[model samples]
Structures are given as structure tokens and as C-alpha cells.
Target: MLADIRSRLGGVAGINFGIGGPIAHRIDHLLSGARAGIAIKFSGENLRTLRDLAEEAQTRIAGIPGVTDVAVESQSEVPELGVHLDRERLARNGVSFAEAGLTLRAALYGAPVSRVYEGRNAYDLVLRVQEVAPDSIAMLERLPLRTDTGALAPLSAVATVTRESGPNIISRDQVQRKIFVTCNPAGRDVASVLADIRDAIDPLLEGKVGYAVHYGGQFESAAAASRRLLASGLLILLVIFGLLCMTFRNARDATFVMASLPLALIGGVAAVFLSGGVLSIASIIGFISVFGVAARNGIMLINHIRHLQSEEGVAGFEEAVWRGSVERVVPVLMTALTTGLALVPLVIAHDAPGNEIQSPMAVVIIGGLLSATVLNMVVVPALYLRFGRPVKNNGGAAGTPGETFL
Candidate 1:
């Protein structure tokens, strides 16, 4: 559909297509600080570089694969009629620039002299020139201007009115003049497309003084939120580690349980790759959740083995490991299956509106559970058997002659 529209509007200059409605655009602006799929910003004092660099960046971005509808933001050019006053001319005609400007404002632009109230609504009573105001320089040259001595003179005698183009609005960020090159992403992730855009433009813009480039739009929030979440994840891990140490009373036991985390990650990473290689906030949250569940399973397995050795009188390391693993197999599989199955519908409905956020999370959790449960049943027990020791009785080594160590 987009391709058809593009084809239909071929050769139309300065026209760029955009996706979504007003609300979506506003959301994009809120997320990215740019109201498009991508925003490449340029800043400088030179208007030429602002215009040239923005255009150049837009063109290069469009050339990159998966970039579409690239264009420099419009509304920067404004058609204005400038009245440049000549001081010598004004003095000779006994006219001041202020007086001439007031005359122009009152006559041509309809200055509001007073207001009239009709009930609750008030209307401006304007004063304007009756004769058709000049639309061209020739006509404006002949327009009358009031002088200080209460005389009238041709506006051309005191000033020059010329048609020119200027910015309707000047926008600044961090006290620097800025222009935005807006574009949409097609057939690719926003992050990859942004990288490509930067790659293509950075070298060309390198070594230029007083000019800088900024990227804005959805990726802005994505990058920031990802950074914060990563930090939070680290903190969560530290807290989890501390809690595990308290629970087990042995650093080695805690470390062995945490070791199973990598096993869980294998499936989660595979799921992300298989579903869509996008790592969103939802996906990160899912990984965090995965850590908790994976840790629980590891703790459950290790604790059961300890119980068998200390309470159930399981004789050998291999026998205790096998018995504990077999005892917990049903419970571990049940827990993992129930959680994964509950998210199956979301995983299937990948294209639903809100599912964009939920689906990745579901996929990650489900995949992590599958691998974590299997590894908990197999690898975790092996780790425990290798590292764990049975509780000592009054006699050391269970059957040796009475001996104790401090």
C-alpha cells in the first residue's frame, strides 16, 4: 500500500509520506522527542549548513536499506514582506521608522483601535486603509506614509518594501539552531536503521566545526529505558545473591544454584531469536522473571538432595542425587508447563495490538522455563553431587571412628 502511494505521487518535490494517526505521532514524539520513526537533528549558526546538512542527511538515510519517506522537516521557510527603512531617506522626508511602521500596521494590516462588546462576545474595531493595499513592490512604493510634520509622502520615499523568505518559527535546543530530518523505518528495526543512518552520515559530517548531529524518536526512550532496566537487573541480582547466601548458609551451595541461570538463558535467547530478534522492554522484564523461576527450581532441587541426605538417611551421594531429582521431577515439570502454557495464547497472538509488548515476554518466560526445568532436573543435581557433602554424625565420615574437627 505504501509503495503504491509512493508510485502514484512520483516526482512530487518535498512530499514525504508518514504512517499512523495524530495520536501515534504524538506518542512517537513523547518517546523519541521526534515525531517520526527516526529524527536526525543538526545544529549550527550557519543557515546554509543547517539546510544543506539536513538535506544531505535525509538523502543519505533514504538511500539506506529499509529507510522510506525521508525528508527534511518543512514549515521552516516563511514568505515575508520586509520593509527596510533608509535613515537618510526618512530624515529627509521628516518621517521616522516607527511612524512609518505604525502607518503600515494600521492601514495595511488592520490594527485594532478599540473593541465592541455584544453581550458576552467582544469584537475588535479595526482601522485599515480603504484603498486596496499594495500586493506588489510597485504598488507598495506608491502607498502613503505619514510624516512627523503631519504631512503624507510615498512609502518608497522613506523605506523599501521587498518580498523575501524567512523562517516562520525558529526552534532552538541547548541554545543552538536546529533542523530535523524526519523519516520512517520499513522492513527493519528502528535501532538498526538508525545505526545505518549514523554510519552513512557521520563520516561525511566529520571534522566540521560548530556542527553536531543528534538522533531522536522512539529509539531515544528505548535506549534510555534499556539502560535503566539493565542497572536494575544488576541490583536485583545482587539482592538475590544476598538472599540465597542467607537461605543456604553456604556460598558454594548458593553459587551452584545460580549456575543454573545460564542453562535457563539458553532457551530464552533462542526464543527471542526464533520469534523476532527484537529485544524490547517486555523481553527484558521476562528475562528478569526467568531468573527468579530458574533460581527457585535450582534451590528446590538442591534443598531436596540435602533433605534426603540429612533426614531420609540416603546412604550414597549418587543415590541421594538420583532420589532427590526423581522426587522433584513431577513438581518441576508441572510448574514450568503451567506457566508456559498460560502464556501460549499471547505467544500465538503476536500481531494483537497490546501483544507487541506481551508476546516477547511470554516467549522469553516460556522458553526459559522449558530449558531451566530440564537443566534443574539433570545438571543441577550433578552440580550438587559434585560439590555437596552429607551431614556429619558424631563420628566423622559417617562410619569412621569418633573424630571431630573444629
Candidate 2:
């Protein structure tokens, strides 16, 4: 039924169906996201070429997997009436083109020459040409126009009427002509679908100059968010490094804490994959959050070892590492368990409506903590033992804040 309406309306109308809830839609828009799963925008100077490209793209895009509801924006030429005025004839009759145009406008459109006020309302009083002849090509030709000589002459003497076709609307982007090839994706991740689209179209458009392709709608927002998140992630890593160095008072220890991030992320990624969740902005945020937790765990265990060596005078490196790991077992388990339990609802109900943004994050966090807690226990201690060599100075066993275990 909707397709029928669109076909009936032809090139004169456009429609877009919004997907997802109001909040999600707003976020998508703010991120410059796609309305459809796949949207390809072709921009160039020639409308005819752009139209052909859009049509060809529409056909090709529909062939790709998971693509459906493929539609190209309307660029079909619409039938129009063209009027050509003969300047010589109008000059010979001492009639200006403006005069003829005004007369024709009044005849065709019923010119509002006056207004009548009644109570609080004002009504337009219009005057129009009478239907003097049956509809025919000769009707407009036979219409009379008054000349400067106060004589009526047929308008056919001064003008010619012909039928032509033109685009119903011309769309421009950044002063260049643009046409859209839109498609919806089902049963696939947007990133995968977009990759396929690019792979399919890139070769065709590669050497073409002054013509460009852009992905719009949801892809737009996704790309923008990805770029922003990447930059933010870099800055976050820097901040984390700075804070760790400040707290540990040593570059090696700080670097060790940072190293655990990848180990923790591995489990998070695995969890998302096992849960059949796509990597989205929410997942990225979850990974970033998990990094902080992983670093915190490393700090807790390492700091505890240093405290034990300084206060209790533990002599062996292996022993100090073992005691530290055992002491932190309860705290680490409780922290990870509490966080995972809190997010259990989100993880379990990931597919529930309105949970699209939260589920991926919960899954990542829960999985990351599980791995990070375990790895921080074993791997961080091993790394600490290997690199955290004790420095002695000044004739006594003077340690750089427990740098020397003995």
C-alpha cells in the first residue's frame, strides 16, 4: 500500500519513516546517524548524470546481502508547459511582455484585485477570464490581448506554446547537485553492511573527479561518533597514565598497570561476541570504563605488596607477590561480582526495547571485570615481580618506598 502511494505520487513527493524510539532517534540525529541502514549520496554538477548514477547505484546496492527496501530519490523529469514570447510581435503591437504576463496571470490564476471586509473577516474579490472556447491547443492562441492602439489582437501572434519536461525538484548540497540512494539493512550489522556498500561502489567511483559519494543517515552519526570516541580514548589513556605515575611514583609501575588494559579488553570483546552483540558506541564506552577498573585493580594489588614489604619486612619477592595476590582475592572478587550483578539485568534483557544503548556496555563491563580481575591477580603480579627490582642506597637497605622488598 505504501509503495503504491509512492508510485502514484511519483517524483513530486518524498517520505521518510523514523526508526527507533524518540530518545534513541534524537541521539542518532545528534550523532549525525543514518535513518536507514545504508544511505549513499552522490553529488555532482549534471542532474542527468547524477540521476543515472543514482539509478545504477540503487540496482547494485539491492543486490548486496541483508539489503532491502532500496529506493533512489525521485529525479524523473515532469511534464511542463513552456511559453515562448515573440519580442518582435509584441513590439509591433506596442504591447510589453509584462502586460501580456499580467493579463495571462489574471486569466489563469484569478487575480485578487480587491478585498471585502465583513465582521472580523476579509474576503478576496477575484476576477478571471471567462471560458470562451472549449479546451484545445487553439484556446490559448485565441486569447485576446489589447494593444496600445486600443484594438484586441490574438495572443497567438505574440507567443508560442509548447510542451516540455523538466525535473520536479532540483536538490543541492554545498552548491553541488546531490541525489540519494537509500536502503535498509536487515539481519546484519550496520558496519558490515556499510563495508560491503563501499566495496561494491568504490571501484566504480574511484577515478571519477568532481563527483563524490557520501554515506548519510545512520552511517553519518556512526562515523562521527567513532572519530570523536577515538580521539577521546587517546586522551583518556594519557590521563590514566598521568594519574597512575602520580600514584605509583614510578614510570615502570604505571606502565605495568596500563598494560593490563588489553588483557581485560580481550575478555570484554569475547563476551560481546558470545552474546551476539555488535560493537557499538556503548560497547566502546564500556571498554574504556573497564580499562579504569582494570588499572585500579592493578594498583590495589601492587600497592598492597609494597605496603607489606615496607611494614612487615618481607624478604622474598615471590612471597611478597603471593601474599599480595591472596590478600586482594576477596576485595577484587567482591568488586567484580557486585558490578556484574548490578548489570545482570541489562545483560540478560539486552534485546528488550529501549535497551539498545545499555546492553552492549553492560556485557562488555561484566566480561572485562571477569578477565581483568583474574589477569590482574596473576599477570600483574608476575610483571611486577619481573620488573619491580629493588634499588638500595646510602650504606643501609634504603628502599625507594619499598622498591627493595628486603
Candidate 3:
């Protein structure tokens, strides 16, 4: 669709196209707003030089594959009608500068002379010369101006009227003039596209004094988000570990429980690979949720085994492990099944409205649950039997010694 639109608009000049995405995607961007595409900002004192550099950068970026809608954000030049005043000519003609300016303004854009009133309405009645084209230099030069001597003189006697080109709009950042060369990436990621853009424009910017180039837009936002997510993930893991240690009252048990996180991630990663293989923000969030669920399952099984020995008067450590695993099977299966079934719809309708982000997330969660549920039941039991410590009841009932769960 984008290619067809570009082809149709090929003949039109100075046009920029913005490609929109799903409604949910647009709403997400609106709520957490950021500029789209790659924006390279060039800042310098000289507008002409800055404009030239921006155009050159734009041309270089346009050659790169997957780049589209390449354009300079600021238009450097636009047609303008200029009236250059001659002070000497004005004094000789006894016409003040203000008088000549007023004459030209009145002829081009009429001034309000009086107000016309109806029963309940009032409108300005403007008076000025008619049948004169404001864009015609000849008509402007022939405009009559009042002189101090009570006589009329041609505007040409005090000023020269000509058409010229000047900057239409000037953009500034941090009190310095700047121009942006922006483009949208089609089939490539923002980082790779921006890297190619940097490589293409590096040579052109070498030794360019008093000028600086900065990259922004989607690339900037993505990079920042990646850093933040990394930090948050690490912090969350630490917090989860701390809570586990507090709950189990031993670091060994907590570490064992944390092992379920990696098990859960194995399925999550596989699911992402199966579903378009894109590790988006939604996928990361899914992984976080999966970690919590995996840890909770481990905690439930381990705590139940300890409870059977310490509180239920179980005879032996091996018996406690067996009975605990068998008893908790139903609860664990129910938890995993309910959550996975609920997310099945989202996973199937991945491309449906408002499901773009949630679908990938659902896939991760469902996959993680399948792996964590099976492994938590089997692996946690084997590991506990081999290494988990024996528990003693407050009532003086004790299990076999030298047995370690951690």
C-alpha cells in the first residue's frame, strides 16, 4: 500500500507521507508520546549552510534501503514580495517612511475605515484601491502615496517593489537555529537504519566548525526504553529473590525456587520465536509475569513438602516429598490450566484489533506456564529429594537427618 501511494505521488514535489499503524498502536503512542522515524537535527548559525547540509544528509539517507518519506522538516526558501525603502528618495519627495509603508499596506491589505451596523450586528467597512493585484510589482510601484506637501507621489518615488525568495520558517532549538532531516524506516529496525544514516553522514560532518548533529525521534525513545527495561528487570529480580529468601527463611530454598525462572524463560523464548520472533516490550512484560508464576509454583510445592513433615507428622522425608507432590498436583494443574486457557484467545487472534501487544504477551505466558507446570512438578521434586533439607516440627516430631532440600 505504501509503495503504491509513493508511486502515485511521484510527480508531486515537496510532499511527505506519514504511515499510521493499528488503532491500539496509535493510542499507545498518544498516551506515551514520542516522535516517529529517524530525525537528525543539524544546528548552526548560518541558515544557508545549515539548509545545504540538511539536504545533503537527506539525499544520503534516502539511498539506504527500507528508508521512506525522506524530507527536510524546515523549508528554507519561499517566494516573497519585498518592498525596499529608499530613505534618500523619501526625503527628496517629502514622503515619510511611515507614510509610504502605510500606503503600501492599505493598497495590499485594506485597513478598516469605519464600522457598519445592522440591528444586532456590526462589521468593519474597509476602503482601499481596487482592481490592483497585490502580487503585481508594477501595480505596487504605481501605488499613490501622500506626501507632506499635500500632493500624491508614486510609491516607486520612495521605494522599490520586487519579488524575492526568503526563508518561510526558521526552527530553533536551545536558542540556536536548527533543521531536521527526517525519514521513516519501512523494512528495517530503527537502530540499524540510524546506524546506516550515521555512517552515510559522518564524512560530510567532519571538521564542520560551529555545527553539531544529534539523532532523535523513535531511535532515541527506543534506546531509552531498552535501558530502563533492563534496569527495571534487574531490580525486579533482586526484589523477587529477597522476598523468596524472607518467605523460605533460607537462601538455599530461595535459590532453588529462582531456578524455575530460567525454566519458564526457556518456553517463553521458544514461544516468541514461534510467534514472529520479535522480542517486543510486550514480550518482556510477559517474561516478568512468567517469572512470578514460576517462582510461586516452586514455593507452593516446596512449602507443602516442609509442611507435611513439620506439621502433618509425616513419618519420613521421602514420604513427605511424595505425598506433598501428589497432593498439590491438582492445585498446580488448575492454576496453570486456567491462566493458559484464558490467554488462548489472545494468542489465536494475535493480529486482531487491540491484540497486537497482548497477543505476543499471551503466547509467552501460555508457553511459560506449560513448561513451568511440568518441570516444577517433576524437577522440583527430584531436586528436593536429592538436596532439600529435612524439616522438624515444633511438637518435637523430626524427619531423617543429613537430608538437604536446598
Candidate 4:
């Protein structure tokens, strides 16, 4: 069936996780993280006697989302183990089907036969062989069979044992039989898609199947980490913006400096995605670095624009803009080159923890700085030339039109 399914689907990369017996039981933690495929379990009056519920569970679990495959390890062919019971060995020891059946019943059957009265409370006495003592196949082989001569004989002399390699159990948290019903999203976020899958299954989970379900994986981790990174960045950005306001002593200039962040972020995010990387913790931290770097470049450009307006006797927009951009070009390039070069070690280092922290950050900073530097050198200066028309000669160099207008 798996071969047929694969054939029907056309060629695609896949990882097979199912193994017969109780192996699925150990996969609960791992399953929580599955982005694709299904985990399964089987339980019924028929399965009540076997160690292999995993195949049954998988059959049912295949119905869950993101589950493309529904293969059962237990159900997969093991033809030799499929041979009928050896009745010839049974007859040799006078172990006819009826007698052997009775022996099996006595070995496995349990019932609350009677209650014993003591003082005040009566407790029911349930009869069952202690499982660990004698119910196992090994113990059963050593069981004494009564011969026609009334002699006790070992049952092992009658029947040979063949270990059945099949499903053992499918359990969740040490109880209940269960399989994973995975949800695989085409393009949606793993977290959002998993949530949608769970929501869809809410009304669908009939507990009548006698199993449990769960969700987990990369999406879960990403959602958690994204929340943390967002909060941290917001706090840091606010703090940095506040410091800029304090240092500049002018809210207008500080606002212009802050605009550099948007200038930097566009290129940084584009580069990150182009590199085939997600916005992981490393990437977000890199993004935070962009803010500081962009702000620094903005400050430099603004300072030069002020100088061009004041000392250079720059009259109107274009002259101040051109002079500001040209004069600040060498300094901004030096600053960016120095910082970018310093981070080269992090980009090349593979195993260092410090390298992990710095690599994405350096990449983001490098990309954002390159962008913002160009913008600061070109657009910012042009804007300064256009808008920073200072009415001077008496008091002081005038601020830009936007600040006065605001």
C-alpha cells in the first residue's frame, strides 16, 4: 500500500518514521514536532489480546491533517510468522484444541468472582494471574502439562516458539493507545496552520476511537521564539530612540535619525529571505542591530547637512543636499566598512556560540547599512537641498521645513 501510494503521488522526498509494534509509543515527544505525515494507533475487541496496536492506530491516525501517509508496521507482511499454529505439537502432548483452549483461558481470563467481608467493608476478589510472573510467552512455554499417565511435563517439549516481530503498543504519556494525525501546511505558518488543523479536528475527535492526539514541531518553537524576539526588539528600539532624542537635544533631528531604521530594514529583510533563511532568533537580533547602525548613519548625514547649511553658506535645497551627501560619503563608507569587516570572523566561524549570535546580526547590519548609507548619501542630501532653506544672516541656521510645519 505504501509503495502504491508513493507511486501515485509522483516522485517526492519523504522520510519514513513508522516501525512495527510499540516504537510509535516513544514518538509522542517527536510527533509533537511533526510538520508533515501521520502517527497512528489501533484498539478494539479484536486487538484486545495483542501487543500490536500501532498499526491499527496508524490506520485511524492517517485521517488527520498534514498526514500524507498511513502505513502500519504491524500490518506489513511477515509471512513466516503468518503460518497457522502447529497443532501436531499440540496433539503429541495430548494438548488437543479444547484442552489447550481451556489452559489459555485459565492463564489469561480475569473476573471479580466474590467479595470477602471484613469488619465493615466488603472487597471484591478479582482473579487474574500476576502478569509478570506467568503470562508471558517464556513463562507459558515452561508451563507444566498434565500427561495421560498423570505425570507433569514441560509444555516446551510440545510446541516450538517463534518470536512474532510486530507492533508492540502505541501509548501517550504511559497510558492509552494513540497515533499522530499530522497537519502539513502548503505555505501557511507552521503555528497558524497547526492551530487551524487542531481547530478542524476539534469537532472531529470522537474519543470513540480509544486514542489520544497532539501537535508539535518547528512551528511551535518558532512561534514561541518570535514572541520573545518581538518583545525584546520593541523594548530595545524604544530605549535606543529615547537615547537618540536625549543626545541630539532636538526631537526633529531624532525623528529623522529614526527613519533610518525603515531605510535599513527593507534591504536587511530582503537579503535574509533571499538567503533562504527564516526570521529566527538570530535574524531578529540582526534586525535590532540594523536600528542602531541606521541611526548612526542618519546622525552623521544630518550633522553634515547642518554643517553645509551653516558654514558653507548653502542657500537652498539642492546645494545643501549635494554638499551633505558628498562630504559625508567617505565617513559613512569608512564606518560601514570598518563595522562590516570586523564582523567577517563571525560570518566565517561555524561552531562558536559567539559566532552564532553575530553571524545573522552582521549579515542584517551589513545589508541594512549598505542600503541606508546609499539613501543617506543620495536621497537624504537631495531632500536636505530641497527642504533645508535656511533664512539666516542674523540669528542662526534654520531647521528643515517639515519640523517648522509640524
Candidate 5:
């Protein structure tokens, strides 16, 4: 039912709207942050300003299409202070840190001096030098300090009142102060939504402030992994082809085996489309399984053809190819079917919804195997028959005494 809706509504292209491009995060970093270098000041004031910006940014992000749950951090703060003590001036005025602190506390919040007890209730008439407690900077500065020589000095004489930022909890990565906002895409692929989020953010954040905003979520990790996976798969294919050539002593057999890969992938990609799914972790895993299984099926068919040509003294190449494919067909089909059946549970039962997971992998493998099984029978044999011409051997080193060559 869901598949039908997507089919009518623009197919996978509309779905691609949610996939993100690779360079989104790097671009985001360059725009929002001052520099990638070490920042000496990740102070409370700096972060508070960042949080305010983030809050505004978060609001803007929430309004964009396909975005949900926008949240940010970096809001560290100190108590709203009216600090009077200046460390430099205190030393010049003959005041120690503790001494200045004690005087300031006494003047601001005068201590209890007297208590009167009654039978039913205890009442205390405390005497404090200052009637109204000094809560404001102006009042606190008026606090009188008795110097060591019996001289009364205003706290203003020793300290300068200033409001400054402070630091609390700090977050870092690679020993560099780091901060980021997290968000979920609403019913969309992480990659596509990430792209949309970046586009919405770029204009608003071009000249925001000192800090930079980066998108670091599961999507980024998966996309990176996907690129690695592609490279790994290609590397595996090249290695396999090289190994096959060495084993068969002929590039012809190796080419036959490698040709099976394209058909195998066709089924995998088709399965993803059929299931109304994205190119997800599970799909990639399925691709891996498909490649391995398809390659194995091709190898089996190729090995059998090579075996028949050398061992059975098969004179005709087409006959050898036909006999080899016929022998391997049942086993290949059975292998493909058994594996496809094994993946049924994953395709049917989704442990976590909204994201294509192991189920898509199962789907891809099943579909790829379905296509590979048929192609392995026809494709591998055709390539072998075309190239496996009975090369004239002069009963010499070209055809080794007991060595089999395809």
C-alpha cells in the first residue's frame, strides 16, 4: 500500500529529496565557526551567546521541511553577580583574598547577634551593623572595611565591581572545545533531511557569531560508511578477479565469473525499490551478501565447466558448457532459494520502524540471488562457451602434463 503511494507520487526521486549530499557538514562548519584552530575562550559568556544563537537557529531549523526535534547545547552561565573584589587592587590595598571575602560577606548578609527564648516560642532580636542587607553592587561597595591599623575603608577603595562571564560544565572532542545541535528528520531519510537542514541553515548562519554549528548524527556516520563500503566492494571485486585469473591460468574464465556481478546487483537495487525502502545499512549489508553469493554461484559454474573440459575429454565447448550448467543448476538454485527463505523473517518483521534495517538487507539478498541464480546458469556458461574454444595444445608446456587450464 505504501509502495503504491510512492509509485504514484514520483517514485524514488521524491525519496531522494531526503538524502543528503556528502559535503553538507564540512560546509556547515566553515560557515558557522570562527576557525578550526584552538579556542582559548570557551567561557560562559561566549557559550551563553552561542546558546541564544542556537535557540534562534533551532527555531529557524524547526520551520524547514522534513526536520524534527531540533535541539542545541553550549549554554553555560555563572550566577548573576555583583562582584566587588578586584584581586589586583586588593593586594595594593593590603587585603588578603580571605580577608576581603569575609568583610564583603559580613557587610552584605550581617550575622545573627542575639537571641531571646520564651516558653511557647523562641524569639531573637539580632543586631546587624547594616540594617538593610546589601544585595546590589552599589550597596555592597559601601561596605566598610576596618583596616589592620583601626582605619575604616570603604570596600570601593580595595575592589572594583565588574560583571564577567564564568564557566561551568565543558564539552570537548580531540581536546578541542566542541558544541553542536542535534535534530531528527520527520519521516524522512537522514541524508536527505540533513541536506535540507543545511540549506535552511546556510543563509541564516552566514555571519552569526564566533562559534560554528556542525551536523553530527547517525546519518553522517552511515554515509561515510557507505562510501567506504563502495570502495571495499570494488576492491573485493578486483582482488577476486585477479585471484580467479591466477587459478584458471586464463583471463577468459575470470571475465565469465566477474560478469555475474552486474545481474546480482540489479536484483538487489530492484528489491530496495520494490520494498519502498532507502539505500540503508540493511540494504548495503544485503548488497554485500548478494555480491558474495552471486560470485560464489559464478565460481561454482565456472569451476564445473573447467572440470568437465579437462577431465572428461569433452571435445565440443558448447557441450561442455551445457553439461556443466546443467549439473550446477539445481545446487545453485537451491542455495539461492534456501538463503532467500532464510531472510524472510527480516523482510517481514521490522524490529525498529521508520528506518530500513536488516529487512532491506534480506530483501536485497533474496532478490539478487533470484536474479543471480538464473544468470549464473545462462551468463556464466555463455561466456565460457564463447571463450572456452579447444585451444590446440602441442602436448607441450602450454598445456602442462597434468595441470588443468581453462
Candidate 6:
């Protein structure tokens, strides 16, 4: 759709499109506040120099692959008429500078002289000299000004009018004038496009004084959010590990359960790779949830093995392991099957509306469930049997003679 729209707008300048849904647009607005594309801000003391630098940067960025809608954000040369008042000429005409300025203003822009009352409502009566047109410089030059001596003089005798251009609006950051050279990424990611822009512009800014460049908008927001999410993910892992330790009351069992986390990762990462190779926030969240589920399955299996020995008086360690795993296989498979089946639709309709976040999450979860379920049932039990301590029954030591492995 965006490509079709861009083609339809052929030859039209200063217009561009950004692809985003309502929820994504709102989230982006909250993150960057009206900045729709990647923005490179150039700041300096001189407005002309800043504008020039921005244009140069825009030109450099436009040549990079996958960059589109390259343009300067500020209007640096807006046309206007400039009026310069001559103090000496006003004095020679016996006219005060203030009076001459007021007369010229009154002629160009009407002055309120009186008010008319109608039905308790009053309207200001304005007075001004009539002209051929509102913006006619010839008419303005012939406008009359009254001096203190009651003499009339043409406004041109005391003022000079010229056509010129200047900035329509001057934007400032940290008290320095700033201009933004912005562009959108078309076929590539923002980070890759920005890397190319930096390489292109670095030489242009070298040895330049009183000027600096800063990246803003989506690039800035994504970098910040990535850092925060990384920290949060590490914190989540630590919290999960602590809870597992508290549950089993032994470091060995907790460490054994954490092995399932890597099993989940094997499938989750593979799923994301198969689905466009994009690792978004939703996929990371799915990984986190999968880790918890994997740990829960390990906990359930290990607890059952201990229960068979301590409570049910199973004689041999191998017998207890076999019986416990056989008993718990149904529950573990049921959990994985139910969750994976529920997410199958989301994985299939990955490009549907409102499923942008959910689809990637479902894909990761489903993949992780497959790997974690198979490995947790086999690997986790093996690790416990090899390295785990023997469980003691209410009567005495549980395992048969010569059968205790640890």
C-alpha cells in the first residue's frame, strides 16, 4: 500500500508516508512525540550555517540505499518584504521616528479609531489609507506621513522597502539554533540506514567548529528501549532462579532446572529465524514465558521422582526414575500440546491485523514448547539421576544396596 501511494504521488515534493498501525503509531508518539521518521539534528550558533549543514547532510543521506523522503525540516528561506526606517531622514522631515513608523503601520495595517454600538454589542471602527492592493509596494511608498510641523511627507522619504527572504521559524535546542535532516527507511532497518548516514556525513563535519550532530526520533527511542529491555530480561532470569532455589531448598536441583531454559532457547531462536529473522520485543517476551514454563515442567518431574522414593518406598533408584517419568509424561505433554494448539492460529496468520505482536510471540512459544518438552522429559531426568542426591524415606535410607548412584 505504501509503495503504491508513493508511486501515485510521483513528481510531488515535500510529501512522504510512514507505515504504522493505530496502536503502533500511538506508542511511537508517546516514545518520540510527533517525530515520525529518523531525524538527524544539526545544531550551531549561526542559523545560515546550520541550515547549510542540514541541506548537505540531507543530500548525503539521500544517496544511501533504502533511505527515502530525504529533506530538511526547517523552512530556511521564506520570502517577505523588509522595511528599513532612516532616523536622519525622519528628523529632516520634522517627523519623529515613532510617528513615521506608526503612520506607515496605520496605512498598511488599519488602526482602530472608534467603536460602533449595536444591540449592546460594539465593533471597532478602523481607519487607513486605501491602496490599489494590500501588498502593493508602490502604494505603500506613496503613503503620506504627518510631521510635528503639520507637513506631509511620502513614507519612502523616511524608509526603504526591499524584498528579501529569511527563516520562517527558528527552532532552538539548548539555546542553539537547530535544523533537522530527516528521512525514512524503505527496505532496510533504521540502524543500518543510520550507520550509512554517519559514514557519509562524518567527513563533512570534520574540523568544523561550533557545530554538532545528534540522532533523534525512532532511532533514539529504539536504542533506549533495547537497553531497558536487556536489563529487565536479566533481572527476570535472576528472579526465576531465586524462586526455583526457594522451591527445592537445594542449589543442585535449582541449577538442574535452569538447564531447561537453554532447551527453550534452542527452539525459540530457531522459530524467530524461520519467521523473517526478526527478534522483536514480543518474541523476547515469549522467550521469557517459555523459560518459566520449562522450569515448571522440570520442577514437576523432579518432585515426582523424589516422591516415589521418599513416600512410596520405591526400592531402586532406576525403578523410581522410570515410574516417576512414566507417570508425569501425560501431564507434561498435555500442557505443551494445549498451549501449542492454542497458538497455532496466531502463528499461521502472522500478518493479520492486531496480530503483529501476538504472532511473533506465538511462534516463539510454540517452538520453545516443542524443544523444551522433549528435552525436559529426557535430559532433565538423566541429569538428576546422575548428579542428584538420594532421597530418604520415613523408615530409613530409600535406595536398595548397591543401587544408590549419588
lDDT of each: 0.80, 0.77, 0.81, 0.57, 0.67, 0.80
Best lDDT among the predictions, by candidate number = 3
Candidate 3 segments exceeding 4 Å error:
1-7, 21-35, 63-65, 74-76, 79-164, 396-406
Q: Which regions in candidate 6 have their CA more than 4 angstroms from the true location?
A: 14-30, 63-68, 74-76, 80-163, 186-188, 395-406
lDDT of 6 by residue, 1-406 (tens): 7777667764676664455567756665565444456767788888888877887887778789988767677474787677788999988988898887787778777889999999999999999865435557777778788888898898889889777778989888789888877667776767777889889887877888988988766767677777787899899888887886666566676788888889999999999888868776788789988888898898888888878887788878888888888899999999999999999999889878679789989999999999999998899889988987767675643333333221
What tens-digit string does per-residue lDDT give for candidate 5 at 1-406? 4335434543443121112334644443344332211111222225556555556666776677756434454445664445657777766766677877776665556656677788888776655557534336676677677766667777788887655555566666555555556554546666777677667666655665545655555665577789999899889888998998887677776788888988898888888888765788778878887888888888898877667666666667778778889999889988988898888877778655643467777888989998888877887777777765553333332332334554
Ordering by TM-score: 1, 6, 2, 3, 5, 4
For model 4, residues 1-406, the per-residue Cα lDDT tens digits are 5446545653553444332224433443365533243322222333333234443444443454544444433223232221123577766766666655544445555457799999999998867533423325677666565656666555566666455654454343455444443323332334444554555444443654543445555455566788988998888778877876665445655666677788888878876766555465777777777777777888888776666665567776466666777777888889888888887677667356446456767677778777877776766555544544443322354433333422
Cα RMSD for candidates in order: 5.2, 6.0, 6.1, 12.9, 10.6, 5.6
List residue ranges in candidate 2 displaced over 4 A.
Answer: 1-37, 42-53, 73-79, 85-103, 110-136, 143-155, 164-179, 199-213, 272-277, 341-350, 389-406
- Give the better candidate number (3 or 4) by TM-score: 3
Count clashing residue pairs per candidate. Answer: 1, 7, 7, 24, 7, 0
Error of 6 at 11 (Å): 2.6
Predictions ranked by lDDT, top down? 3, 1, 6, 2, 5, 4
Q: Per-residue lDDT for 1-406 in model 3, tens only?
A: 7788877775687675556566623543443332346677889999889989998998888899988878777474788789999999999999998888877778878889999999899999988865578568887788888899899999888888889887888878899999877677876656677789989988887889999988776656556677898899999889988987776677777777888788899899999888767676778889889888898898888888988887788869999999999998999899999999999999888767678679888999998998999888888888889987777775643333443434
lDDT of 3 at 49: 91
Q: Pairing residues by index, what is the TM-score of model 4? A: 0.51
Candidate 5 matches the true fold with a TM-score of 0.65
lDDT of 5 at 36: 14
RMSD of 3: 6.1
The candidate, 3 or 5, that scores higher on lDDT is 3
